[model samples]
Every structure is written in structure tokens, then in C-alpha cells.
Target chain A: AQSVSQHNHHVILSEAASLELGCNYSYGGTVNLFWYVQYPGQHLQLLLKYFSGDPLVKGIKGFEAEFIKSKFSFNLRKPSVQWSDTAEYFCAVNARLLNNYGQNFVFGPGTRLSVLP
Target chain B: DTAVSQTPKYLVTQMGNDKSIKCEQNLGHDTMYWYKQDSKKFLKIMFSYNNKELIINETVPNRFSPKSPDKAHLNLHINSLELGDSAVYFCASSIPLEGRSGNTIYFGEGSWLTVV
Candidate 1:
């Protein structure tokens, strides 16, 4: 079975500090990666996704993630964090297949990020 | 407008009772899914419906049943609910047809269920 692992359970960072959250998966086949964020009392929203393109994928809110197949990792990063960036981040993966329903996503235990001003 | 919506934002019921969580997506998406977020905030897929047809049913209990009257609606019905069923239920939608672009899932504000 495929599984996703998020190394950090909680992270506290001051405003304008650099941010990086580790994510790794246990799949050997082709995969589609995603990063989703959930703010307090808000629904989960897609932050970025990596399909079959450049290894480095940029997403909304000045966030970006790099897909390293060799490491089985897709780590989320932000050059500078803001207080508004305080949220829970989840890393997910879906196997690529022609049948849409055949693709099931595996989510990692979220990392709660607190950006202090 | 909310692309995906789940009714009864909060549900409180006793064990052994029956209840339903209604989900609807106005995005005309072909695929709809039901996911459960436990108290620990770990989200898991329970069921998925594509074009009103059951496609992915995870290792869910038999007491939990999902119904899809149309492509835009997928409702979950639980019979003899247990205390373990207390969690947030989220409804999501995505395009599943042929030639569909990247599968981008849109989730709605979850329905928090508390079974006492």
C-alpha cells in the first residue's frame, strides 16, 4: 500500500523566516504530488501540484515544492513566511493511470505551522 | 458560490442510531468522494462515486452506505452508527471524464459528526 509521511508534526516560525516542510512517499511508480493547506475553520485548499513537468513546481501564495524521485520526496518550501501562512499543511500523492477513478490519493499526517509575527 | 457543500455542518447523535450526511457539488464534476477526518486530523477516503457509479470503496464498514442519485450528488448513510464514527466528514469533487486535465480535488467545509 502507498503511504505518505510528513516528518514535522508542528513547526513554529517567525514572520519573514524561511519555511520548509518535509514530505516523502513509499511508492515506486509514477505519481502525482500535491500540497494542500487548511486554515483555521477553513476548508482544505490546494496550494500546489506536481504532475509531469519540471521537478520544481511553483504554487499559489509564494509557495513551491520540488519533486525528487530518487529521494521519494516532494518538499514544500517558501522563501519567507508571513503570519497569514499559519495553517496545517498536508502532502498527498496519486498514482497516474488512465482511469480517473483508479487513481486514489494518499495523504500524510498534516504539519501544523505557526507563523508568529 | 460553494463548489462543494455538505449539509448539517454539525451532527450529534447517539450510538446505534441512523443518520445521513448529504453532499452536493455544483461544479458538474463527474467524480465525488467522501472522506473522513479523524480526531487526530488524519484524513482518509471512505468512498468515491464517478458518474453516479461506485468506483472506490475503501476498507469501510458495512454499516456505512453511500448513495449517488446523480453525478452531482453523493450522500452517505450510516446505520447503527458507533462512537468511533465521530469525526469530520468532507465532500470533494473532481473531473473524471476522458481527456480530463490534472485531477484537482476541491473539498467543502466538512460536517463534524459527534456520536455519543
Candidate 2:
């Protein structure tokens, strides 16, 4: 089974600070990557996604993720984050195959980000 | 309009009680998923149904059953619930990545289940 790992369990930063959350997947194939954010008491929202285009993908809220095939990592970054960016971030991966059920989708534990004002 | 919605957003029951969570998606997605987020905040896939057919059933206990009446609805029923079953359960749907449509999964607000 494929799994995703987010190294940072909890991250604390002040407003205007840069942000980078690491995400790594153990799958070696044509895969789709995604970054989802969940605000307090809200549903998960798509931050960005990487299918088969440029290695770097830009998402809403000035966030971006770079898919590094060599490291099996797709890390999310923001040059300067705001207090509203405080939320729980999740990293997910899914193989391209549709029939294989097991490889359908996988989500990481999640990283709780607290952006202080 | 919510893309993915689940009913009984909050469920509180005692041990050995049986309960169910209902989900619906208006996006006309063929694939629906049931995921449980434990207290540790670890989201784990419990079941996946594609076009009303069971496609992925993880190593979850048989006590948990997922039924898809149609492509847009997938309901999860739990029998003889345990204290460990107290967690937030989420319903999600997405177009298959192999499909021509963009495959972006959307999640519900989450159904909080508290089993005492």
C-alpha cells in the first residue's frame, strides 16, 4: 500500500513568515499529488495539485508545491503567510491507475499550522 | 452549494450501539470514499465505491459496512460500535484520475461520532 508522510506534525510561525511543509510519498509511478487545507470547523479545500505538467504548481492563496521525483517528495511552500493561513494542511497521493483499488488514494496525518498575528 | 455533503454531522452513542452516516454528492462523481479521522488526526481510508460497486475495502473490521445505493450516495453503517470508533468520519468524492474530467477530490465538513 502507498503511504504519505508529513514530517512536521505542528508548525508555529508569526504572520509574514515563510512556510514550507514537507510531504513524501512511497509510490514510484505516474502519480497525482495534492495539498488540501482545512480551516477551523470547515471542510477540506484544495490548495493545489500536480498532475503532469511543470514540476512547480501554484495554487490559491499564494501557495505552491514542487514535485521532486527523486526525493519522492511534494512539499508545499509560501513565501509569506498570513494569519488567515492558519489551518491544518494535508498531503495526498494517488496512482494513475483507476482499476487497482488499493492504489486509489492515500492521505498523510496532517500538519497543523498556527500563524500568529 | 456543497459539493459533498454528509448527514447527521454529529453522532453520539454508547458502546454496542449501531449507527449510520449518510453521504451525497451533487458533482455526479462515480467514485465515493469513506474516511475516518482518528483523535490523532490521522485520516485513513475505510472504503471506496466506484459506480455503486465496491472497489476498495481496506483492512477495516467487518463491523463497518459501506453501501452505495447509487453513484452519488455512499452510506457507512457501524455495528456494535466501540469507544475507539469515536472520531470524525468524512465522505468524499472525485472523478477518476484516468477520466477526462479533472480529478480533484472534495471532502465534507465531517461527521463527528462519539462512542462512549
Candidate 3:
């Protein structure tokens, strides 16, 4: 079974401040990582994903995440955040199930980010 | 046009009543899933269907049943709903690559179900 854990429950930052959200996963096999964001009264949208190749994957709205295989972490980062960036962030992992054709998708408890204007 | 869409964006029903949420995907994907998001924003996968066949069942209550009439449509029917069933249900679809976790998953707007 694969599970994801996010470090912060709630985060507050001023505009133009750097942001980093920690995410860790527990899985024994190769995994695909993802970051999804949900604004107020909206559904989850994909922020970025790491399928293969590059360790540092960039996403929309000036966000990026690095896949540190050694640490079992995929941390999301941004050089600066805007008020519009305020939203709930969720980290997810997809691991192919053994003897099954479908993938097992698991999501972490979301981290609410509030950006002060 | 919505790539993935679910019906009844907001549903309010009394306890012990039965309700159904319909989902459709125009993306031509083979895999469809039903996920529940609690008030605390915790997401749990309830069921998944690939090519109209059940693939994953995550220990969800038997009251909640998922039906896939085709690859493009998956419906969730809850029998004798309870207060604990009040949550946002999301419909999602994705395509499988050559054995790797599919590149991306598209999600619906979600159907907010409130059991009174």
C-alpha cells in the first residue's frame, strides 16, 4: 500500500515570499508523483507531475517540484507567491499495483496555503 | 466543453434516502474512478473501473455502489445514505500508458452531497 504525508497543515506567507511544501511517500516500487491545487469552491487541478526523466519538474503558475528518490520526497517550491496562489495543495502518488493492471492512486492530507496580499 | 463532468453539482437529501451521481468523460479514456473528499479535505479512492471492468475497490461501504455502463460513463449510487456520507464526490478519468502511471488525470467539478 502507498500513502502520502504532507508536513504542513496550514501555511501563511506574504506576497513575494518564497514557498515550499513538503511531501513524502511510502512505496516500494517505482512511483509517479503529482501536485494538485484546489482553489476556494473549485475542484482539484493538476499543478505538476513527475513521470520520468528530470528530477526537477516545473509546473504552471511558477511552481516546481523536485523528486528526491533517496528521501522518498517530492517537495513543491516557488520562488515567490501571489495572492492568487492561495489555495489548498495536495500531494499524490501513483504506484502500479502488483499483479494488477490499474494503478493505485493515493493522496495526502491537503495543506492549506494562505497568501497575504 | 468539460472533459470530465458529473451531474447534480449540489445535492441535498435526507438520511435514509437513495441518490445517484452520474459521470461522463469525453476524453475517450479507458479508466474511471470515484473519489471522496471529506470536510477536512482528505481524499480517498472508493472505486476504480477500467474498460468497464472493476479494478479497484478500497474497502468502501457496500452501500455505495459504482456502475460503469461503458468506458465513457460511470455512475455512483448510494443506498440509504447516512450523515457520514455527506462529502464531495469527484469523478476522474485517465489513460494508461505502457505500464507506467498514466501521464495525467482529469477530474470533474465534483458533486457536493449533504445528508440531512
Residue range B1-116, candidate 1, lDDT tens digits:
98999998999999999999999999989888999998778989999887888888889999999999999999999999999999999999887633324678889899999999
Top-lDDT structure, candidate number: 3
| Model 2 steric clash pairs | none
Candidate 2 lDDT, A1-117, residue by residue in tens: 588999999999999999999999988667889999988877788999998779999999999999999999999999999999999999999775444543377999999999999
lDDT tens digits, residue span A1-117, model 1: 789999999999999999999999998677778999999877799999987869999999999999999999999999999999999999998764334345567789999999999
Q: B1-116, model 2: which lDDT tens digit per residue?
A: 98899989999999999999999999998889999988877889899888998888889989999999999999999999999999999999987666322478889889999998
| Per-residue accuracy of model 3 over A1-117 as CA lDDT, tens digit each | 789999999999999999999999999888899999999989999999999899999999999999999999999999999999999999999877676587767899999999999
**CA lDDT scores, all candidates in order:** 0.90, 0.90, 0.94
* lDDT tens digits by residue: candidate 3, B22-68: 99999999989999999999999999998998999888989999999
* Candidate 1 displacement at residue B99 in angstroms: 7.5
Angstrom error of the Cα, residue A17, model 3: value is: 0.8
Candidate 1 chain B weakest ten by summed lDDT = B95-104
Q: Work out how many backbone clashes candidate 1 has.
A: 0
Q: Candidate 2: lDDT of A104?
A: 74
**Which residue runs of candidate 2 sit more than 4 Å off their true CA positions?**
A96-103, B99-102
